[model samples]
Target: MSLGTVSQAGLLLALVAAATLSGCGQQTLDNSQDVAAALATGGGSSSPQATERELPTFDCNALGERASSIEMLICQEPELAKLDQQLAEVYAKAGDKAVNEQPPLLKAEQRGWIKGRNECWKSEDKLQCTRDSYQRRIVELQARYHLVASTGPVFFACDGNPANELVTTFFETEPATMIAERGDRSILMFSVPSGSGAKYQGGDYSFWEHQGEARVTWGYGAEEMLCKPTTQDDK
Candidate 1:
């Protein structure tokens, strides 16, 4: 996640451009990967030497004379470039699973996500911000699209009421994640460092599990509910 020093001024401008593009609702180009591959291949040469050189999934050269600050960073940083490639592969798999859906939900969401990732320049720790942005997005796509192995639709009765239950499925993502569904609502939470037990938080929900019990708060400012796993296998 560590990136070398970069100019803050450049990043600020990049953030502005990213936000503007996002607001304008830019559509993702379908042939972007092809274009990138061509660039990596040195004008479609595709020699073994050219293929040996690792490049970002997107066209770093396509940025042309005046590249965005974020783009420049990704091009220069191997770690970031590797992450970009990983995300591209995962995204492609997810897209295949979601191909039948109307309106192409995955494509639209990916466009928005790219904008959000570019906006990471606003953070004081810009490198960490960018890295976290990629990691979280990868975990999200994996969980949402079920691209990884998973465990449990484990049920938990909350507040001593069997009817008031939470159903959770854990995914084997990098940071580990769980989707908790109650009624018609579902929240995807990522694991966080905890002193005593596993803790996950996302959106308006927070869940902590210790032993066979859990404490959960489903919404902002809501009372925490004590829960016990009702499923023996999960316990």
Candidate 2:
């Protein structure tokens, strides 16, 4: 992995710490208090209903004669249209789960996300950006709602640091969630794909895999980490 100047160990540590902090109050764990405090809040809406709610469906046909530029572009492109259909299908399943649970907060977030997605029309790569936004959001909902099955826990030992590792355990939560643990510390990570590889994000950190290497970042203040896979016991 060509990570340039980033410290792979620090990046892995930051990612694990951030994930642990996000899952703090949501579940009980035998971890440190410092980590607990860090997990108390997350990068989600300030709605109690954030954890449960109906996923929103986007309709290109429903727009009829009055479609936004983004919608029009999506409908005009075959690939984009396919993505839109896929997103709608997943939204339907997630919405069913949300209606039974009645999570008003999630509904609100969907609306906000739609607005942000539409704003991508102003970007240089409008079509690609819009398509990516849909794909990422679909991954988030599918993972959050447990609409799809998770393969199970995956471990990656950081390069140059035999003692550092990342472990992810998937769960069937109201909004599908995962616990990422490294040693006695753990954090929450939500599903968000980065290309064909799985990418999880929480708080100030994110973990992604590309071309068989794990790329991670702790926050805006830290450099990214690229590490190779090794035996879980290698840590």
Candidate 3:
């Protein structure tokens, strides 16, 4: 992959960290946390390790409407829409639970997939029998308890990737979620495809093949920001 600059490499490392952080039954992390520790430690582009890590930090709970939100997951194998939906349901349930149970107001961060429907452009697979079969739901977690927002495409992780492994296929699937202490609000980006198998510090990560699985990450606090439409013709 032709990464143009060191910053691009950093973004790839963040994505690597994102993609490498998922699993089954108390799935322990093997390759993601190194970047995690770096980001957590506040190390910026100055680290060489950041230059080589190309995978994304894997969390199945993030969701959004735009393609960039979910990054390469949907860009490559969008067939996992149904898988995304199941994961959305999980997050929806979790949000409901959190709202009803009303956990402590203390600051915290967490992200995971909840099975549900996308509030925006929801698409169905070509197979009529399997319409909505793919993971359809996507969400980007937030601090102060909100699963989705008026943002971009959401990402998720599930039990496995089914036979349908293209942007055209969609299958029913769920994902792993975890509530944890929040981190920096920096967004994760994709600098290289998961197939690139790019190596980082003797560790090459691969996540593009991951279908039916959702990935998400949560951070500690949130800053209330505002949004407004601007005129295209004006500077």
Candidate 4:
């Protein structure tokens, strides 16, 4: 072959090699674009799973057009919604314990409680009332069901008479709580700020304990009873 012909053949082979590289580069560019598009659209199986978010116990969006003001308020307020979720969880646990009971007491009580909660609208500060209602109910269910740890059935002899006695049990609830029982009567009280000792107040009842002695009043306008802790031997 002539030198020119040989040179022409070599140039053709080089040109073919360049075309092949160009095609490969175009394919690589397309593949890179595909990966980017998949990432941007969150489309590929290899993409990380989305972080899950918590939702309220009830469907906030399903409140519908005729939903009550209180219902709407609960749905709108994150704190109230969270409280509702907490209450539902606590109530479910209580219900599970009461499942074997004859009357389904927990279920009935929950229905009544819901009615009472709705009555918060009558108060001047509905939000505060509702919040208080939820907190109290949660604490009550927790204590009543033994869902939380408690510190006593500690006995207190009122006015130095063992016959006139009050039974007290303190529970580890949010803000803490105590149930004071005298005869058939029981009052649930919440912890309050006190300059000295520990104090709890609920409705018309107030109990204050310092050292081993307690001053308790059971009724409205009732005289305070100075009580001392008693053991089984004292009873």
- State each model's CA lDDT, in order: 0.85, 0.69, 0.33, 0.85
Off by over 4 Å in 4: 1-54, 100-104, 122-125
Query: Model 2: C-alpha RMSD to truth?
Result: 30.8
Q: Which candidate, 2 or 3, has the higher lDDT?
A: 2
Descending-TM-score candidate ranking: 1, 4, 2, 3
Writing each residue's lDDT as its tens digit, candidate 3 over 80-111 gives 44344454555555567476454532114232
Worst 10 residues of 3 by lDDT: 164-173
Each model's TM-score? 0.73, 0.47, 0.18, 0.72
Candidate 1, 49-129: lDDT as tens digits: 244344787777589876666777777776777788889989999998998887778988999998888887778877788
Superposed on all Cα atoms, the candidates' RMSDs to the truth, in angstroms, are: 21.7, 30.8, 28.6, 8.4
lDDT per residue, candidate 4, 57-131, as tens digits? 766678799766777777666667778889989998988888787766787888899888888878898889889
> Worst lDDT window (10 residues) for model 1?
45-54
lDDT for 187 in candidate 3 is 30
User: Order the candidates by lDDT, highest first — what do you get?
Assistant: 4, 1, 2, 3
